[model samples]
Target: MLTRILPPPGPARMLIFITMVMSLGQGLWIAINAIYAVTVIRLTPGQLGVSLGITAALVLISSVPLGHLVDRAGPRTIQLWSFLSLAPLTGVLLFVQGFWSYLLVTSVQGLAYRAGNNARKAMIAARVPAGDRARIRAVIRAALNVALAVGACLAGLTLAWGERVGYQSAILLTALCFLVTGLLTLKEAPVPPVPAAAGAAFAVFRDVPFLLFTAVDGLLSTHGLLLDIVLPLWIIHHTDAPRWMSAVLLLINTAFVVAFQVRAARGTDELKSASWASLQGGGCVAAACLLFAMTGGAGLFMACVLLTVGALVHALGEIRHAAGSWTITYDLAPDHAQGQYQGAYKMGVDIGKMFAPALFAWLVIGHGATGWIVLAVSYAVLGAAVPAVVARGARSRATAKVAAGGVTSSTVRM
Candidate 1:
């Protein structure tokens, strides 16, 4: 089990270690930042929301350009500087006294985070072999999950202490994590920048099929919001499950991902298999949504059972969706432009993050069971549409290849 969960000793292992450390800080910050903002920083809920929203918008706007920078500057250098930049930005959070200052710090931090993230993805593309990319990504993700859970627990302790010092300690610890990760990144083998071609810097925008696929994948990615934002509220307002069940459901989801993400990624190294995984994963999520809907007005025991089962099903879908998305993103991107392409991929996810919370709140929280049904149908439609979109994208690429002369090394399996 350890061997299966751990990547082989090499660059992959090193990357996983970096990811774990990064995610540990992220988990700590995520769990405590809102509370710290509201309680310690004295920001109103609305102010906090505005700051985060603006930060998300900045990240979305900056992702592609930063990614292009990675392609031009080399992944290692960009990643190192981006990671190093984060330490000071995060440390500055300790001194933010007003909404404007908070917003400024967070916005810059968000862009730094996106840049580092894009560089890391490009590094994976450049360093990892195609056959092992998805599997290694899955392992990294599993490690991330475990590390996040541990970090969250530590945050829980800090929160329990209920002192300003504890809050500051968490912030400092997070900043230190960023610093350490940045320094550790220096040990990674340097990846040379891809040679620039005319009109290549922003070419991802010209790929209509890739854009459509990104949009669809972005929509599918909202399954995360469904789990994190929607389900807890559903349990409270719409179902008879105990309030504690929300935490239990989260535990189940985390445990399942840590255990099964690599296993789920086994067959997704190829586009055909990855697309099928996406479809099947969507179906599982849709089924879970239906199960969640059935929990409304149920007996306590029945609702508990339904919620537990739905969480497990959702976890299965989450792992598969993640595995497929990674593989498809890698396979579809041009070899010379992985950074920009990954930036585009991150843009899709950032868009989802910006809009998904409000959308799910209005849709599921406002409409109750009917909202869940609607969400289920939407996921089903989106999942069902993935194969067609992938097929279309593949055909367009093949056509472009033929026009260029014949199939080249960049051509992927149809």
Candidate 2:
């Protein structure tokens, strides 16, 4: 990880640093933001939830258009402006008083964030080659986790300063980080050349099989949300495990991801292999789900043991799924339309996030241990089906190629 980042290419390296900075700064916001609003902004939990929901809606609505912009303007241009804009956008939090003010500012920031994220992903995909992209992304992701951990500690320190000042300083620091990252990204190099687009960005929509692949992969990606939302609720309510163990579970997952991401990314550079890896990862999470379900009748010590083991298994799954998803998302994109393609691809993620809370709650929290069993089976089945989906998409591409008397590389499209 150190080696990859140290001598990294000029533009991409700075971009990677920008990612770390973003993660680090937002890391503080992860746990603190809610509390900040409840106390400093003086809003109810329901109000906060409503505001966040609106932001999510806006992001989902804006993503594809932003991607079109990326393809048209180039990632460098969009990225620089997005990051530069975010500094003031984030700083707006300092003046937010109530619901409307918070919503207005945060929603705009969400636009910047969504567009910036789309541009960043496309830029990275354009910068890196197919073969090296997976490992490079793995290394960058691992570094992000480390940066977030440090930010978590920083957040903890800020909270120690009490309510108003702590929240204000954190927001300011976050804004500064965005500003600096934006400035540094100005030096980024041009993306590797591709044939200029002669058609509308919406060509991606014509590729239906690729969309289904995105849907399935999006479901697989929800494992992170499962950890964030489902696990804690399940641990506290369903299992005999102590609530404190939720933190332990997160730590365990983080440790595994940071330690093994690059290693897990190997052999998944192509679609078929990456799809298989996704299946394996889904299977691991399913198994972990069963383990978690078993802790109901177990004693406290035994429950803790089960939770820890299950968390480790889930972490392994996270590593696998992330590696596979990262590779396919980049590799399957058309170079000329990467911005739009990647942007469209992210719709899958938005779908997953939008559905996870209610869907998982209904399956797990509402139904009890049996819910876990159902979830495990469903997750594994979806994952196992991925290769077939990719195959379909690949065959579709091949057919199109043949119709045009053109050729393509052997890699599957999904």
Superposed on all Cα atoms, the candidates' RMSDs to the truth, in angstroms, are: 1.4, 2.1
Candidate 1: segments with Cα more than 4 A from true spot: 1-3, 404-411
Model 2 worst lDDT window (10 residues)? 192-201
Q: What is the lDDT of candidate 2?
A: 0.82
TM-score computed on alpha carbons, candidate 2? 0.94
Compute each candidate's TM-score over C-alphas.
Answer: 0.97, 0.94
**Candidate 1 global TM-score:** 0.97
Candidate 1 on 12-130: residue-level lDDT in tens? 88899999999999999999999999999999999998998888888888888998999999999998998799999999888889899999998998998989999999999999999
**Could you tell me the lDDT of residue 44 within candidate 1?**
99
lDDT of 2 by residue, 72-94 (tens): 78888888899899999888888
